[model samples]
Target chain A: MTPDKLKTILLVEDDDKLGRQVRSHLTEAGFEVDWLRHGHDALAADPSQYGLIVLDLMLPGTGGMDVLKHYRGQRCDVPVLVLSAKTDAAIKVRALDLGADDYMTKPFWPGELVARVNARLRRPLANAGDSIEIGRLRLDQSARRLFVGEESVDLTRVEFDLLLALARRPGVAVERGWLAEHVLDPERDGTGRTLDVHVSRLRRKLGDRAVCLQTVWGVGYRLEPDA
Target chain B: MRLRPRLALTALLAGIPLIAGSVWARSAIERSNAVDGLTRLVLQRMLDGGRDECSRWPESWPIPSGPGMGPGMGPGMGPGMGGEGMPTWEERQTRMQAMLRGGGGPRAFSHLGPPVEFFAYSADLTSRNRLAPALHEDLRTGLLDGRKVVSRGRSNDSDSPLEIAVRMDWFDEPESPSAIVLARQVGASEFGLAREFLWGVTALVSVMLLTLLLSAGPVVGRARRLTRNVRRSATDQYATSIPVEGSDEISELALAFNAAGAQCRAHTDLLEQRERSLREFVEGTTHDVMLPLTVLQGHLTSLAKTSSGEQAATLRDAIEEAHYMTSLIQNLATTAKLEAEDAPPRRDPVDLVALCERVVARHMPVGREKGVRVEPVLPGDPVVVRGDETLLEQAVSNLVHNAVRYVDRDGRVLVVLSAESGRFSLRVLDDGPGISPDQIGHLTERRWRADDVRARHPSGSGLGLAIAKEVALRHTMELTLGTAPELGGLEADLQGALG
Candidate 1:
C-alpha cells in the first residue's frame, strides 16, 4: 500500500444524491473514491490510473456505453462495475458481454455495491503477484499449482480454482455462490447442493489441513489458513 | 364439417341408392309381370282352343290350322270347341281372345286386374285392337323360340305417360304364328321414380336425423365440459384437468385444455411464491428500517420538545440518527445480497482485535457521555478470521451498541477478543440488566421469529442481535448469548476458527 497509488476508485454517476451516498460509503470502506459526474470527464481522464471504476450507465456529456466502449476498446483492464437503473436482464448481459466486469441494478444497497467492487478488486490484488502464501498453504498462480508446505499436492482444475479463490483472500469468508462461480461454472448455482458436495470433497482432499475450510451455515464458506 | 353433420350426410348418401333400387324393382315387377302373364295365358288359350275345335269337327269339315297347332288329335278337345266344325283361324283367334278377355281366372287372359290391356297377335304377328306391342321384335323372336318375352314402353294413352309394357308367349309350337300380347298401364310413369325419390329422401332425412341424435349427446356434452373448465380457469377456479374421454375431436380439445391448465397452475404457483417472498422481504426491511426511523423520529420529537437550550445534544442525536440511517441502509443491502444465489460475498481477512477495538471506539463516545466505561480486552497478537470484513465490523459494533444502550449510565461494557483451542472468539460483556430467562434461550434463533423479545423490549426492534446472528452465520461462526460469570451481565459471544 503506497500513498500515491492508494486503492482508489473513479466513480462516474449523474445522480447527485446517489453519487454523494456511494462516494461516502466507498470512502468509509477505505477506498479513495474520485467521484465524477460526467462521462466526458471520465473518458478524457486516464482510465488506467484507478484500481477500479464504478460507472452509472446514464451519464451526461457522453453516454456511459460510449465511455465503456472506448475504454475497453483501448484495452483498459481495470475492473468496471456498470451500475444503472436499467434492470432489464438483457441489458445486464450486454454490459457484461461488452467487458464490464459486473452489473448492478439501481437502488442497490451501498454495502452490496461495495462488496461487488471489493470482489472485483481482489482479482488484480491477487493476480498482481505470481504467488501467495498463508501459513503452511502456498499457491503459485503462474503454474496454476498449490503446495502444502514443502510437499507439493495434486489438485483437480476445480480444486485449484477453489483453492485459488480462497487462498487469494485467505481468512476471508467467501460466499458459496461466489466460490461456485469462480471455482466451477457460474450457472451451477441453481441447485446449491452441488457446492456443498464440492466443498466437502475439497475439505477431504485437505485432510489434516481441512481446518482451513470453514462452513458459514446459510451464508457460504470461509478459508482460514492458520487454523 | 363437424362430425355430427358429416356423419349424418354420409348415412343419407348411403340410403339414397338403396331406396331408389327398391322402388324401381317393385314398380317394374308390378307393371311388367302382370302384362307378361296375361299375354302368355291368352296365347296358350288360343292355341289349345283352336286344336280342340279342329279335332271335334266332323271329318267332312275342312280344318283351318297353322303350324304347331294340334287340331283334334287330342281326345279331351271335344267340349272345348265352340261347335263341331272346322273354323277359320281368324274366328278361332277371336274366340281365344274372347275367352282370355273374360276374367282373371286360369282360363282368362284379362286376369291381370286394372290398368291392364289385352292384345292378340295372329299367326302372322299382326296386333289386334291397335295396341302397340312393347319389344315387338323381341316378343316375335321369343315366340318363335318357344319363350315368353316381357318389355317396357311409355304409353301416351293418357295425358301423362303411363309406364306400359307387354308380355307375349308363343303357343303350341316354337314356330307358331299365333301369340298373345298383354299391356298394363302402371300408375304415372314417374310415380315409381318419384316414389323412389321420396323414399330416398325420407331415408336420407332419417339417417341425417339419427346421426344428429347420436352425435349430439357426446359432442355437446364434451363441449359443455370444456366450457365449464375454461370458465372455471378464467375465474381462477382450480381443479384437476377435465377428464379426457374417447379418441375423437373432443379428446384432443381436452388434452390441449389440460396442458393449458397445467401451465396456468404452474404460473400461479410461481407468482404466489414470488409474492410471498417479496412480502417477507418488505416486512423485514420495513421493521429494520423502522428502527432507524423511529430513532430519528424520537430525536426529532425530543428536539421539538426541548427549547434551543439543548441544541448541542439535539444536534448530536441528529448525527447519531444519520449514522444509524447509513448502517440501516447497509444492512438492507446485505440482506438483498444474501438473496442472490450466485453472488459470493466479499470475503476479506477480518482482524478481530481491530474489529473489537473499532466497536469499542464507536460506542465509547456515547458510553462516556452516559458515564459508562466501554473498554476493549483484545489479545496482544493479531486475531483474524476469514469473512466479510465490513459485516463482521457491523456485527461487533451492533453488539457493542446494544451493550452501550442497555447498561446503566456508569456501568462497564467490555469488548473481548481472544484466540485459543485453534479458534478465535469475540465477546461483548456488560454489567447491565441481563437477558431474561425466557429471552436468553431464543437469542440466536435463525429466523426473525423473536416475538417474545419484541414483546419484552418494546423500544428495541431486536434488529441488532438479528444482524449479529446473520453476520456470524455468514462467517460460519457461533453467536451465543450467555450470562458472563465474571461480569455478571449479558455476554454476546461470536466464535469461529482462527485464520
Candidate 2:
C-alpha cells in the first residue's frame, strides 16, 4: 500500500495547542488530518467525506454529544471517537449510548487516539448478507473471499479472523488484548507482537488495499476504509 | 416583723410603764411632803390661837366648846364665859381645871388642887415628870396667856400644870379668837388635803398610762407592718419577686431584686448566643474545608486514570493523599453536625449484611493487592436496621479500610453482620499487631499515629474511626473497639439502629 492512498480524518477539539500537535503527528505519520476547533464546524461540514471523526466532548458552540446526535440523526454513519476529560463510567456509557463509536478519557496518548480513529474508519459496512464492504475492500464471510477493487484474494483461517475482527468495526482501533481474546485460541500465548506479525502477513496478501491497515504507534492496529 | 422594728417597738412599749411608775412615785412623794407641811402649820396655828384667846379673856372666857374648840371644851358654857365677863384669875383657873379634869361641875370651885399643881410646875422640865417638863411648860404657858393649848401630848395623866400664853389683842378688836382659831384650822386641813392630792395624782397617772397604751397601738402596728413588708420583700427577692408598690425601703428592695433578675437573664442569653455562634463558626469552617477536599478527590481519581509509568505512580500517591484529606474533612464535618443540639439522623431501613459486604468488597482490591484475605460472614436472613445509609456505609467502610491497611499481607480481616435480640451489629476484625493498651487511649483522636507502627504505611488521617464513632452517636447507636479473640487485632463493633 502507498502512503498517498491513506484516508483523511477530521479532528474536533477545544484545546487549540493539543489539536495542532495531534494534527501534526498524524500528518507526519503519512495520513492527512483536518482539525476543527469547534463541534459546530465539524457538524456543518459533510462528515461522509471524511474517513473518520475524532470529537472532543468539551467543545465550544456545540458539544461532542450534540455533534454525535446530529450525525447519527442524519444517518451519516461516519465513524466517531469521543474524547473527554471526564473519567466517570456514567459519562462513558452515556457517550457510547448516544451513538459515539468509542469513548476515550483524556489526557489520552496521541498514538492511542490515532489508532482508534484508524480502526473506526476501517469498520465494514453493515448488511444482512455474508459479504462485508468497507470502501473498495470486501470480505465474503461464507465464501471466505477478500477483494480489492473487484479482484479476489485468498486468506488463511487466522488471517480471516484478523480481517473479520478489524472489518466488524472499520476505522476503529481494536486493542491487542481484544484481538487476542476474540481471534486467538486461549491455549496460545499470543502477545501483541505476535498479533502484529499476523496483521503484516494479512496486509501483504491484498496490495494497495493494504493501505487500510494502518499502524498506530504504541497501540494496536487499525483499518481505515480507502479514501 | 423585722428585727429592727420589733426591737424599736418593744423599747417604746416598755418605756410606757417605766415612765408611768416614775411619774407616780414623784407625785406621791410630793403629796406626802405637802401633807407633812400642812400638819405642822395646823398645829402651830392652833397653839397661837389658843394662847391669844386665853390671854384676851382674862382667865377663861369659858373656852370655846364646839368642834373647833380646844381639847377639853364642851358644847354648853356659862353666861360669863359667853359674854367675856372678866372673871377673876382664880375663878378662871377653877373653870379651866373643871374643863381639864372634868372633876368639877360647871360651877365654881371645881378643884382646889389646881393652884397646888401650878406651884409644883417650878421644877426642871425633865427631872420630876414622866412626861417632858418642856411640854408641860409649853401647855402652862398657853393657859396663862388664856389660850386653849392643843398638842399631840404623850398621855393626859401627867402631874404638871399646863402653861398658856394669851394676848388680848384679837378679843378687844372685835375679832373673836375662837373664829380666828376655827379659820386657821380650816386653812390647814392636812388629812383632807392629802386625800384630795392623792386623788388628783391618781387621775394624772391614769391619764398618762391611757395615753401611753393608746399611742403604742398604732406605733406598734405600723412597725409590725413595716417589718412584715420588709421580710416579705426579702424572701420574695430570693425565692421569686415582690411588686414594688410604694417608694418605701421595701419597694426599693423589690426593685433591686428585679434588676438583679434581669441582669442574670441577660447574662444567660448572652452566654447562649456566644455558644451558638461558636458552634456555627465551627460548622461553617468544616463545611468549607469539605467542599475543596471533595473536588480534590475527584481530580485525583481523574489523574489516576490518565497517567503512566512514574507519572501514574505519582498520581496514585496524590490520589491517596487527596483521599486522606477528604476523610479528615468529612470527619470534621460529621463531628460538627453531630454536635448540634437538634441534629436528627436521616434514618432509612437498610440491609446491614449487604452494606457490610459492599464495604468489604470496596476494600477487597486493596486487601488482595496486599495479600490479605477479607472474610465476610453475613447472616442468611437479611439483618435490617433503620439508619442513615450513607453514614452507615461510611462507618463500615472506615472499619474495613482500617483493618485492610493495618493487617499483615497474610493476615485475615473478617466482617460480620448479624442481628441479636433487637440490635443489628456490623463488626470488622483484623489479625495484625493489635492496638496496644496505651495506644487505644488516643486511637480516636484526629491525626493520631501509633508510635510502634511503621510510619511508611498509609498512616490514616486518623479520622476514619472518629467519623464512624460520631455517626454511630448521631444514630443513637453504639460503636466500640476491642481486640479480636483469635485474630488478636483490632475489632470494631457498630450496634443498634435496631428498628
Model 2 TM-score, 2 decimals:
0.36
Off by over 4 Å in 1: A1-6, A133-165, A169-221, A224-227, B1-499
Put down candidate 2 lDDT per residue, A1-227, tens digits, no spaces.
12233377788887755676667656755678888898779779877777677888878889888988898898977677777654233455577678877655443334445555554444333434488887888889888778887898888777887787776655444445556656765666465567777788898997877888875432345667744
Candidate 1, residue B448: the lDDT equals: 37
TM-score: model 2, chain A: 0.59
Docking class of 1: incorrect
Candidate 2's C-alpha lDDT?
Answer: 0.57
- Binned by DockQ into CAPRI classes (incorrect, acceptable, medium, high), candidate 2 is incorrect
Question: For all candidates listed, what's the TM-score of chain B alone?
Answer: 0.39, 0.44
> Which model scores highest in DockQ?
1
Instruction: Give a tens-digit lDDT track for model 1, residues B1-499.
Output: 7656676677777777766676666666644554456455445544556334323432211132333233323222234444544456666555444433433234343334333333444445654333345435655565556545544453322223232222333344443323344344343434545566667667676866786767687777788887887776667645566777888887888888888888888888898789668746744664445333423433443343354547756655564455455445544544444443224445566567645644554455446545687755544346777766656766787788778777886898877665666787777888998898679777667453333232434246367778788777767788999997657789998889977
After best superposition, candidate 1 residue A28: deviation in angstroms? 1.8
Query: What global local distance difference test value does model 1 have?
Result: 0.61
